[model samples]
Target: MNISPNGINIDEALEALAACTVWYPDYREAMRIITKCINTTRHRKDPSSAMLIGPTGVGKTRLCRMIEKDLGPTQQARNSECDKKTWPCVYIELPESATIRNLSVVMAQVLGGKPTDNQSVVILEDFIIQRLVTIEAKLVILDDFHHVAEKGLTKTKSSLCNWIIKLLNRSGVAFLISGSSSAEETIDLVEELSDRFPYRAKLQPLPMADKASTSVLLGVLASLEKEMIKLGHLKEYAHLTDPTPYKAIYLATRGNFRRLSDLLHDSFEIALLRGDYTLKISDFAEAAADLAFCCCPNYFLMSHSQLNFALKFQTNKSSETAKK
Candidate 1:
């Protein structure tokens, strides 16, 4: 393990590593798709919507954040100075205080769009339309949609989803929805709304044969190493290598990028405290042992053979490519 003068270890500087690597090509593609959707809908007269379906921890939140980051400057400009009045994107997490009335209120606030609560649906609907028209929002991203169903906010969900569709049908604004796979089924229960999401992207786990994916995994660790270096801890550990941390990472996290990151990060800290500059199999072993006790069934039962197969698959592909 190499140590830096700052005593930084793998966990400090690259905390984002513990979340999701935006550098992954697959994840990047998802971001690209979202950006395209924003561009297409931004100028449209009616609203549009998109759905992102994936297992937990495959970077849905990260992708959403990336969209926000990219759109922030233009969104801010629109919010502050645009006479044409457009909302490039407005994001709301569905789990938070999402009653029908409150959700309407929040969306109204975000889009500079109005909520017409004149004690009449007609008045309320008109107010909302006026607000949306005033700002000209291109797309709205509703995240954590699973919470909408879980909270028993069926009417709220219906009203909100319907409102979004109405915006799309009548005003041409696009919506981007992101949630767990369960969310798709939940949304499907409301088929009318689900039909509106013509574009859907489901982020799959990193394929084991994808050197690009595995390499990105190491790239994340290397970033972590830089963090450790900042803490004057880089030299304190051994140079990380093959079967390196990835073995334990792949097994415990099941290629869920977020979970893999969390596992490595939490475990690395424990390993560092044990005073080893070089991370060994034992560092990961202890980490796995701890994870086993945390009630994650997959982590506890991950098969060594499964990991071996993945590694072998990667090796053969590399060899074949080299021969070619």
Candidate 2:
């Protein structure tokens, strides 16, 4: 939001700019782990596969996308003759009710190959390896790995998982997978496949204690406030770091990055509409009220006891620390 004005467009700035990135410690750690896997992928004797697991709102998908952009930019044409492009990293998000053959075709599509006639699982396996080798791909990320395992772990689903393992090992490329917590059970269905993905990481929600985690949450809020100020949308800081407001925000968002972002986004939109940039507690309440499975009321409307019961106000620790 604090972009330079020179040689820039400002009229549609607010509409074009997205909310401040919710980068945090856990996000960086995940990136480091995956990057290391990519770096040492081909050197390993076995497959260099890792699993990133988390529940919803933990930014699993966002992190994977960031990795793709940072590590694998769009394919650049390598030659002038045919203008062939090399894909270093390939990402595939498992479709709902995914099957082995379906997964194969999607893989081909991501690798810039169409599913040819008479393409069977065994034949597709070789084609996929050949494409990966030709493209010089070092990493292949499969997001939403849980989608295929949504139903009870059936033989077909296990086979699909096995095929992925074989592909990674055969192609000599790292296969980084990400999904919800249920993905662990999906991996366990095929023990050999589970063994292939040895490095597993979890992205958990931020806590609201009176210490480090609280500081991180405050840092994020402060950054958002700074952007608003730079955009001339806010006249002054919202004091989001103050105990009272921060406590309410943490409780409402449950310290989840995406939820926090969503809450701020909703409040920001409402403020722009009301011809003000000041983010109010009522704004947060309304934003949270729109959340799925949420029944919290506006902060101004709910009494102290009612608000406490509704949002559970730092029930993870103590009401005392939350006050700090």
Candidate 3:
């Protein structure tokens, strides 16, 4: 692989892959919920919707798309009038300017029509329902439902939620609403919609095992170590995986996969350009200093390299003093 300014090109490639990978358990659960909702819509009379709540970059949107693709065309196979142009899976991002009127316009546009009437808002919503029925859409995923809250339009949020509930109760469209993990915040905004979805799933953060599970995270770091070794920066900073360095990395990232990935990516780039593999205590300190200056303080001020060197130096000085 051609090495870029950021140590190895593989870091970026690995980051991209890691971003898409849904780990093990979350993947299975997400697939199950989506399938259940779609199948329920097809075979049942009173269809209900689901809400997928989680933090940002926790694979919520990706899971939604994956489920939609697996359902295959989203409607009944027997509808001959249904053209491919009419997609069964309609994914809508809640806009910043969310009002009853604008939302109606958005829905109308999604259904391939223009909003042109005194009751255009009503007509747009009805069009969406009818089209969904026509396409036999088993699922309608509304990603970033929290945008309504962020936009400071609680009425619009309530209206949108009400509209969704109506679809679930009447139209048989299963909904999957994604949101953040703060329990209080989630409840405050989506409290009304919660009663409808009895099956609530939370995407828990990855566990950081002491020694056994540490390898899972370390393996990620090891990969970077190997790449940096190849680039000749390992000798100076090779202690990054040593006990001290390992603890430092763990403390700094707090087991957040996205932040961990970003830090490793940037650190490797810095190390490679500096042309040092054996990362010194000063190097880690310098990195930390730079971070603090940039207003991004690492949990620990002293880099592993700095700590290791300082300890070693102190030990030698103490031994010399004892001999004298």
Candidate 4:
């Protein structure tokens, strides 16, 4: 078994590996758009909202969190002239069963307001608007915006979208909505709301069959390998840039970044358990089966035979283990 000469243990190494965040070109483009939206909204008379639509596991939430971190929290005033805090950006996730009142409550909380259940939606909305103005927030980021469609809240979703349009008109703050592709359905319900969010940015998974996309995916893998080595997570290069493991990962994750990361993390854990520091195509196959069975039951049975054929050199250890 190969081990790191840096003396980092397997557990610690795997932990570090899992915690690393890789920023690719698509994410950077999203960040650029977010920054531009914030700036435009801050200075313009008519505030514009942006929509970030992507499929599940494509790092939509991760991108929003990165923006929030970059903007940081509100800072309190030191001088006596103005004693209010100034929050440049506010971020919140819409509730699964989202309603106007609950959405108000969530926004109020983000703006440092304590909203009670007894408070009327009108009061909460007013309070949220005032707090947003008080803090002088330039941008508002709402994640999981697609949840408005869940539980058949069509009427409520329409009302909420209209309210958001009013909020932007009144508050002069840019609203950035991030959600899955289903979010488009919710937005399209309101014509005005759809028109207001004219700027749309989408994060797409790397295409498995596209040569350019494959090259970019391979580049990401190579960069991740370099990052792990730089962080002392590996004693030597994992050679993830090699065709064997690269193709195996692409097949397993279908070029989804989140799934690829999860697959790699699980494979690293397996390698650690087996006292093998090097990553191999077989490890990814095993990790895919393990992850699919544990978290995605829908894909487990169908993927077993495919995984076996993808890496024909190895016996179906993952399937055998699944039986046990």
Clashes of each: 40, 0, 13, 0
List where candidate 4 sits over 4 angstroms from the true fold.
1-6, 9-16, 150-153, 209-214, 232-238, 272-277, 293-324
Superposed by TM-score, candidate 3 places the C-alpha of residue 78 at a distance from the truth, in angstroms, of 11
List, residue by residue over 44-66, the lDDT tens digit for candidate 2: 64566788899888888878877
Overall lDDT per candidate, in order of appearance: 0.61, 0.71, 0.59, 0.72
Model 2, residue 101: what's the lDDT?
Answer: 80
Error of 1 at 23 (Å): 2.8
For residues 1-324, what per-residue lDDT tens digits would candidate 4 score against the true structure?
445443447667766776667677887788888787777766665677788989888888888888888888778876758676898889999988787777888888877788887999878878878877888887789899877655455787778778887787777778889998777777778888787676778898865433545376876787777755554544544477655555556666767878877877776766655553455546555676767633343222335455446545323654677789
Q: Native-vs-model 2 lDDT?
A: 0.71
TM-score of 2: 0.82
Question: Top model by lDDT, which number?
Answer: 4
lDDT score, candidate 1, position 71 = 68
Better of 1 and 4 by TM-score: 4
Q: After superposition, how far is residue 275 of candidate 2 from its true place, in Å?
A: 3.3
RMSD (CA, Å), candidate 1 to true, equals 7.6
TM-score of each: 0.67, 0.82, 0.64, 0.81
User: Of models 2 and 3, which has the larger lDDT?
Assistant: 2
